[model samples]
Target: MRKKLFRATVLMVVPFFASLLIRLLYVTNKKVFHAPKSVGSEPIIFACWHGELLMLPYLYFQYRKTPNAKVLISSHFDGLLISKTIEYFGLETIAGSTNRNAAKVLIQGIRALKDGYDIGITPDGPKGPRHEVADGIVIMAKKTKAKIALFNVKPTKFWQLNSWDKFIIPKPFGTLHYYSTSEIDVSEMDIEEAKLLIKEGLLKHEA
Candidate 1:
């Protein structure tokens, strides 16, 4: 019982500090935004590789200061940490993954879109065979008739973890070069076609 209480306490406290640390790193780093023309006022889908997830919440906030956005996250422990961390940046979270709670993701994702909330998803996330586009993203876009935006950030100096996604941590004081694609409409494409487009768009700038 004591151990469980300590573990619960750790979960609640870590995300708060983690978010602060992320902000610290970002504020010290040089940021270059190479954004395209705005996708206008309509809610749109945002997709990126899972490896690029760390700095994206901050980027999203820079793009849409009056944010009405929610990120799709897994229902597992790490996802809880990520969900709470991004919440510090005023982003809500939808608890689901491509592998677990998938139906919940589809339902909540479409609902969020129809209600004018932008949704962010890491296509091959929460257990990735890295850099692959999952079907859930395609399904959600089709259901809501929303456009998808592909995003990527390249850091001048960073540490790459050996994790499945080879997660990146931009070293403080280095430059972060950001890029985003124009809104992509997958509403008319069949599932396989849409997934291919998404995967290609995301990997276009990959090293």
Candidate 2:
């Protein structure tokens, strides 16, 4: 009974705060937050830390000039929330992660890139050494001939979640900051180079 009550309490609170974040932080003229650039006519893999997931849907709804997009998420229950939120904004999800059929899920993401869809991935995710970059994104971009765009979200009002990923939850009615580094054209760089650059860029953004 206690667990059921706890779960019920969580479900109600999570969505309420999520909606609060949208009301406070999802805004226009994101240009000041990120530099604009053409990501080539080919598809892109938008890589951001797990903490940035809160603003991701809004970023998609606001900045997507493309017709297709899908985010690669894990099979965890949180993935269900992420999936539902993205789909709620007319996006799709390709579920798979380091724990289950990771390769297949990655291939699906690459396929989405090939078929003309932008993809978002959290390099440090599904449980993480928070904010570290993983090589999987580099490998996938290299194989798919896609560019990578790195994003970071700085909250104006939020608490640091105790989850392994240090999931960030923003309180209602506060500004949020965003940083989008330049695209890394994987075709021009090796996997190691891509990973290094992406990692450096994200770290630099945090600093």
Question: lDDT scores for all predictions?
Answer: 0.88, 0.72
What is the model-wide C-alpha lDDT for candidate 2? 0.72
**Superposition TM-score, candidate 1 onto the true structure:** 0.96
* lDDT of candidate 1 over 92-111, digit per residue (tens): 99998877888878899999
Candidate 1 clash pair list: none
TM-score of each: 0.96, 0.82
What number of clashing residue pairs does each candidate have, in the order they appear? Answer: 0, 0
- When summed lDDT is taken over every stretch of 10 residues in candidate 2, the lowest stretch is 23-32
Over 4 Å off in model 2, which ranges?
Answer: 1-32
* Candidate 1 structure lDDT: 0.88
